[model samples]
Target: MESCDAALPYTLIGLVLRQPSPPHRGAASCPSRFLRDYASRATNTLLWICLISVTSLLCRRLARLVRLWVQGSRIPGPPSNPFLGRSKLIPGCGSLGSLTGYLAELHEKYGPIVRLWLSPTQLLVSVKDTMLIKEVLIKAEDKLPLTGRAFHLAFGRSSLFVSSFEKVQKRRESLAEYMNGRISVRANIIPSEIVECVMGRVDTIMAKGTLDCGLVSQQLAFYILGSTLFGDAFLDWPKASIYEKLLITISKDGCFWASYTIPPFWSREYWKYKHMCKRLKHLTEDIIQHCVEKYDLLSKIGHSSYKDNKDIEDEARFNDSILLDNMPSGVLLQEEMAEYLTSKEELCGNILGLMFHGCLATSSLISSILTRLALHPELQQKLYAEIIAVQEKTCKLDSDDVQKMNLLMATVYESARLLPAGPLLQRCSLEHDIYLCSGVNVPAGAIMVVPLQLVQMDSYIWGKDAGRFNPLRFLSEATDHIGTHKKYEDFEKTAFLSEPKRKAAFLPFGYGTRACIGEKFATLGISTLIASLLQNYEIKLQPGSENDPKPIMSDCLLQQLLSSPEVVFTKRSKRKTWKSKGSS
Candidate 1:
């Protein structure tokens, strides 16, 4: 290829030489001096043009960089090398966990509100202060572009995780309505369904004697989510394992690729990743089609009419029958199909996102909680006692029973506090600057993060033993005092203190308008599984397994937790069990 500078001058010279030779004197009669002067002038003109263009380009880039530096300079953070920024802060190969840990360290050294520069153009501001975190989250509802791009290959453009704010909000509202209605109507049945699914997984683990709890828990979560999302239909899906494997692979690799901003077309491994995403999408479509066919959902949905307020109230009386008969398990009932989704792709994307989020986080959480339980047998007995009390109060375990067991809920909450599914909650301001009460203004396009784990584990906010695993801290009894009237008054005074602080600090699901919508459904399902497991067997760490480090929660972009600290499930000596209503 010819250089533009050289090509331009040569073309000008050729044109001058071919100008008809001035017609009269011809080429020979033309003075050599005139030709030399013209060529010299043309060369000079081209040289000056090239110089100005290069200088202008450089100046523009420099000005943009200067503006970026100025924007980040106002915030306190570790000094980074020019252009390279803080990329080296993350150790070898890097990971979501490593980045999170690095951010926490930065917050300690530099203040709660710290700035990080991934590059001259990419800036990240991490807020660990409770008040600031709440403000930033409330103000910035959009997710970072990097996160969206990372999972774009797998989740699709319309996924809840990647869509624009208005679209995401619209989709979320639609999904939330369906979820709220379904969960309310079937609340009692969900727990029993979860327990049955969990028991089957437990039987497999017990039969194996000493299996990796991570693998078993992964399968357990997958089964429960599959059932919850697709109902009994998923049990008959032949490619279920393949579907799970694809999800795991895509999720694990998406973060790494996103961190480096490596597009699929740029690497040799691109094909494999692309293939997995394609297969996952296809599988999702297949299951969706199967469910639609199984219930003749298309016809039913077509025939369904929009109910007015009075009709809705009347329908509420027969909600159970209407729900069960009109919709098959796991298939969402769309009030207005067009309003809820534009195409099957949108529905599939959301379904896949739901499955990915639920399976990865719930499984990891369940594994972590069980691992903690195995390590602390005394705690297990306490939890077991709580579960039994609830069971005794009711004939069979249900959503109501799950709610009554505060200690059980506390145990789950405590475990989540220690090992959160989302290590760092990320958001980006897209339209305007976010002004914090503390006078720090987060600029648009700058990635804002809340290091959820760091805040959750802060000793100052949670007392001296914040890092330790203690479920009682979450229970009301942990702060209760049975003493004089003065003590009760003192408790009343301090009650408001912790509640607001804890609300800001403890973010298991998240905060603000974008918080996880499936919190109640997930909690109920997890509690039921734990309760059912406790009823049949006692969880204990295998001999010498206690020496292994407790499994930690990874970033949401990767596997939630690896099953570690090998554990065994042995039948409890004295156990009480009841069959679900439909059980044989």
Candidate 2:
């Protein structure tokens, strides 16, 4: 039976192998059957792949949700929609003017610490509480330093403004040596000359008797910053008109916001911004190249002169010539900085970054002060008296002189407080979660906004007259009980300058290690310009313009854009007499 079974299996295999010759039915039928089988297999394989992909995606999302739940629930916030979050509900959410008002309303309704969602994936926690602000800005700053992908896109990743904390610290240390007290003293000598030149040009424009102070201040700021940073190189690079166009285009909110928030392919504004960036990059490169060539030529001349066996007197003269022939002190420092930093590209990025920052912020500050001064002639008189007193004490007006004018300093501080250069400071926690004093635990990758505008303008903190423009509020003594005293009825009297006991409550130039390095520079420049203007000109609102000079808060690329009313500049006889007195 076993032998029979083996023989049968062999016989069947032989038959199957040999039987293929008899299966030639219709050729078309065979091919159709084969195609059907192949299609069925392919369809099954595709279905399995799709099922696996869907399963993986769902698992990932589920895991993420589980992780969030395990971490802890978020803080109290306004009710949000599923996809849009609170963004759709906030009026003018994307527009700066409307955004400012909306944020104020949010704070009013939600208390000091408020939670908000920008989108389904993005969370924001805003804290105006002084204690919590201190904890966020000062205590755990290293762990939760300022970070913005948008800023990184606008300014290069290597830019000090967008760099990592460690990198920023290194750059700050390097820059401090050049921008410190001694350098400031040297820089103080030039503003007077620069301001004088700018005023001369401004006088011609104001000859028509009706002036746009906004335009005038912008021009003055550009020239001052240009000369200060680039020295004489700016004069040869491009006309003020070209620069104005470039700056206006570059500084527009549409340019930066679009680039920061939207994809270039999807956003027309972003594409335009990219083109502008390219143009700016080219312009800056040309400037840098010119500087390099000039430096090299001077270096060669210096070396050759030394090698020519010149006498000691000639050598000393050559040395002096080289120093005098060098680029502007600011530019020279940046050139030296190029060696210490990564590359020239980084230096250019930083230089342009500072240019944008100094030009816009300084001009806005000057405009704000001028508008305030014009609105209140009495205050203008007071500021002028202070400037006069300082000039009288010292034969010349310098940074030190500006510093001593208490009321002038107070006025500057007040303007900055009310309409800060940067109204909102955006920060993010990248490394770990942050726990606020209110016990609100913000998750990692969440944005934390320090509502500087709201915090500075809080009625509870600054009293009921917080909305009023009163410079005396900053200079008042903490012990002064003017808030309760009815007798102190005058605007200045009611507003006392209370020294800020809580540091976090006031941050015009930010606070801690990451504070604006150009604070002192900006302060010196603004103070010098204001002091000079007050000394030489009486700024008044144009006869036909608005009677009250209110700050028109416009949408800006970066922060609150302050524009002053149209005003006329009338040269003061008092200042002319003082100048003669100093000359005599």
Candidate 3:
């Protein structure tokens, strides 16, 4: 027989206990039976609660697993950490703080279209396929490409570099009318004056015997820009020192990445960047004020009504008379300022945008080309020979003279291909989803990156020698049974000379309607300075320097040599003259 005492409560203070067993000899009263039923009911309810909780937890986990599987199936990418994504998987990416090498590795591992996660929320897709690049940059570029938050912070929302597509389009339309005329006029006349400025610096370098070509190139770049844009005022200003300070503040350690990712407000670098932006804003305002005054002076002189003149001769005379002492004609800067002059803040923003984009980008290009020339002494000699041949015929190295030097033009194009100032072109799918020829789909809010370095250096498109610097690839041979004709033109238009297959491969300035408006001006300025330097001196690498003779590229928004290289400049004496055998 079972024991009835087992069912009895330990304490029966308020009521009697009851047992649920057949009547026994010493059985408790009916109260015992009731107590046993109450305890049994309570126990069953507690067990049911636990069972439901465990079943709910298991179901939720299974749903999460299914979600991850679905998301992972849509695109191909390297293995990523669950939380960190692929942020740390890239080698030298964190320490070096560059995506160039990292992107190259990804392309090799996962084909042309590769997806990467900067963080859990930020997804990046990079493309190296040429046709896809065209589709993103040209065909589907309805929205302005997104510049990361770091750029937005550094440059205001109104800046063309970071502005929305609609706003940029409006600004571009207004600015184009002025820039096209100004660039055409400036390109023709500024080359000779720029040559003079470069030669002046070369004189100092020759006397010193050895100098930092990197620094010299930067100085030349600024001087050319200042003279053309600011006129006599830039000479008086501390342009070199100011430009250095701007670069230091803009590219300060941890600032760019921090501003974009998780801005460390408590950190010293962020505060410094904020302070720098303030200082730069004031400086830009002052520059604009000077430009306005210069414009007023031109108007007083009855030269303010000058329109875009297509006649080269007529424009040359006007440019010669007005553009004195390396002062800009002030037409473009003045007009842009007048439009925004009502608001000082807007004016300052526009001017700073022009200064940074125009000066910094061009300077990097100039410095890279100089470093390349210093390393290759034989190339310098060949370029010098070309310059001398042109000088012998023209008596003066002017715009027309420099334009005829095919080898010189080729060298510039090749250097640009090897080391583009802007390595990665960033865009965002703001308006609608963008689908590529490769069948990779980029959602509306996702960031799209075009790896120019990877595309331009691809062996499949550019041949095996693409990795090597050979300007001759641009020069095609027209061979007959008995003779050959060498072809050359302005580097900006040299794309036509390239084989039909490789026309889209070279885009140092950029592409599409929204491409750089100052391309002609910059190309003219760089070519002019280079020709003058080659005409005067033979440049070679210094014997002992910490930096390598060959430049090591670094990415800091723009691609520049990691360190400035030291170079020796030897002045050239009178040499035998040579006649051009064929037209370039």
Candidate 4:
């Protein structure tokens, strides 16, 4: 063996080139070759690791985007803001009646299944997609849930406005059972009492020939609600008017002005709210205490738990004492029986909701209907004629007689069309896959809504004059029957042909099994009040007004009540006293 250490570098190169080289058996292989091998292997491994990570990230991002897009593509939805999704375009959502104008425009744009925003979240807004909406509202809406802060921001969180559903159901049932037989005189005693207190002021105002409609509406609503619900006996309409102002302030803030008050976790609004809540709490406590005291004796006698009474009849009949003895207690017990409500806040929330619904919805609807009637004297005349026909036929106003006013029903439906109380009410999503309508499908979990206002006014389904206010269009029944029926033809789904459904549009009440529990009650109240009023005096708009007195129509369906465009009403002179032009 040759000891040629100096030729190692050259020998190594020669060996790789397959040339014969002098053997350097005396020197071991240099350590640098092993180091080089490791360096190359490490570099290749790092490169592969980086490549895989980048590929995985891209694939995940692509998958998420595809899912959202596929979910969106099922319905013909409007373009949404990339950042805010639908909220940037929806205008107002939680605010009362804001949904009306939004849905109107949405229907105008997208056919039915619209991508919308309720709280800066993607909401699939549909009018007829009940199956999906039920899942959201009844099934999943609470998953996110309402916070105490949200309730306080809207209604002092101290009130029952934030109450859970279970509580309200139980309380209402208990109250109902308790008052079943004992409330016989409650109805008559209250109205007469209200008249005694308010009629004088009404007469005074009438004599003065000037009226504040907003104040009047609030007063009337408060008095009516208070008397009927709380058994308030001597509430003068003037004092009731003040109460109305307070509630109006609260409602306007709660329903419309929420963003201004809400702060992260807590708010300075709480400072203001604290004072308001103290007063409200005291007032509410007083009323509740009074109700509790009303049947304190009964409570004492029947203080034992209802569970102790073994006989079913005794317990059932005992509902009266159980409820009247303690208003809150009775309500809580009843709600438990009905729905297992757990929250006290919800109890107050429901009461507050009642106040809101009664004051704003009922009164605003009344006002809106009156406004339309005032503008269209011909329609009024027709409605009056119907009223007269009913009265004459029955020889008096009665339950059966009220049912016969088909024209009245039509006019009411018509009013709902042009000036709906609210454009749309939401139902949360629940199910996985949902068929919105024919040829349109949403994925398993979806938000469905029966947007009657939007669906009814679909120009494609309803024709070109869908924007116009017409009542007669909805009244058409099948003069000629063909064997073709569409699944969802008219808003009401009046009838069915074979393939395409028969046309009878205009569903103001709502769609499906859970429409509205109080539709009949509301209809009765409005018809009766309007009938009674119109029969006594003619309602006319004030002439020669200084202001334009034009209504500020909300583009959004559910607007704040105070924002409701005001109209002036001037009662007409008695018809009997008016003289003929020539005769005079």
lDDT of each: 0.68, 0.62, 0.60, 0.48
lDDT of 4 at 540: 53
Predicted candidate 2 versus true structure: per-residue lDDT over 500-524, tens digit per residue: 4344567777776667666777766
Best by TM-score: 1
Of 1 and 4, the candidate ahead on TM-score is 1
lDDT of 4 by residue, 1-584 (tens): 64444443333345466446555654455336534655677788999999999999999867755664567555666665434644466656432245556665665666545665442234454644434434333432211123334445544433222333332343434443543433333322343344435445656776777554444445555665565555542252224454456566665544333444444346566456545645554454455456556545444555554446656435433433322233444444344433323344444554555566666666665656665655556666766666666665543344345446655555565555554455455443332444433545554334455555555555655556665544444343422212222222231333221211133344454433333434554555455555555554454554542222333345343453333233344454443321111222
What TM-score would each prediction reach against the true structure? Answer: 0.76, 0.74, 0.71, 0.60
Candidate 2 segments exceeding 4 Å error: 1-73, 85-88, 91-110, 139-157, 232-241, 253-272, 289-342, 476-503, 549-560, 574-584
Q: On TM-score, who's better, 3 or 4? A: 3
Question: Which run of 10 residues does model 4 get worst, by summed lDDT?
Answer: 575-584
Estimate, for each residue in 411-486, the C-alpha lDDT of model 3 and write its tens digit.
7777778777676766665656676667766765456777777777777766766676666566543111112122
lDDT of 2 at 515: 70
Could you tell me which 10 consecutive residues in candidate 3 have the lowest summed lDDT?
Answer: 478-487
Q: Which ten residues in a row have the lowest lDDT in candidate 1?
A: 482-491
- Cα distance off (Å), candidate 2, residue 513: 3.4
- Candidate with the greatest lDDT versus the true structure: 1
Could you tell me the TM-score of candidate 3?
0.71
Stronger candidate by TM-score (1 vs 3): 1
When superposed on Cα atoms, how far off is each prediction in RMSD?
8.2, 8.2, 13.4, 14.8
